[model samples]
Target: MATSRRVSRVAELIKREVSQMLLHDIKDDRVGAGMVSVTDVDVSGDLQHAKVFVSIYGTDEARAETMAGLKSATGYVRSELGQRVRLRRTPEIVFQEDRSIERGNRVISLINQLNQNRQIDDAVAIEEVDEFDDE
Candidate 1:
């Protein structure tokens, strides 16, 4: 078992290395079809497994291809980590598609739409009050 600090450090390190791999090392054309970013990494307290959350920006087909490419490259990524990192044993890597960013954007758009509607309602109410005052 590893301390929480050590686990977090390892997770950060993994995230950085994975990002580097995506930028320059990964050669899969499918992965290149989308804009891939490592959103976060979750390391088990035991430090034996890691979940890598990634956000891919593209059309649905492109995202699907990118995910497939990532899944196939998992073994290579693990081997690279084992060689580059000084862990006693390399943690197993699992890639997960993160949709939180997309969801957050959708929520923000909805809020903005609601705010615009509220402003319009307020303006109409003010106009009605002015007419009532004149009568």
Candidate 2:
């Protein structure tokens, strides 16, 4: 059984290498104008399958294009991995769009909106209390 730390380390290495390859090696036109970030990687316990989580900064269309490009280039990526990493077997690669960044941004926006609304309400309430005191 692979230790959690070992799994995490391998995941990090894969993410780094894959990101570099996407930026430099892969020459796919479908990968549109945007920054691609490898958010996370999940390697199976047996180290035969790898799920790569990527975050693309752009519209949904751009994200889809990038994902398609990645999927199409999976074989090359795996082969590259086989050459770069000293592993018994190069794991099959799968690309997935990470929505955690979007979710986090939404949460932050909502929190800011709530805080602003609360401030406005508090100001109004304070004015009302002051008016009553004056009366």
Q: In terms of TM-score, which candidate is strongest?
A: 1
Candidate 1: segments with Cα more than 4 A from true spot: none
Candidate 2 per-residue lDDT, tens place, 1-135, comes to: 688888888888999999898788988877655568889999988788899998899987887888888889899999999999989988889999898999999999999999999999999999999999999
C-alpha root-mean-square deviation, each candidate: 0.6, 1.1
lDDT per residue for candidate 1 within 12-50, as digits (tens), equals 999999999999999999999999999999999999999
- How good is model 2 by TM-score? 0.95
lDDT at position 22, candidate 1: 95
Worst 10 residues of 2 by lDDT: 29-38
Worst 10 residues of 1 by lDDT: 81-90
What do the candidate models score in CA lDDT, each in turn?
0.97, 0.89
lDDT, model 1, position 120: 100
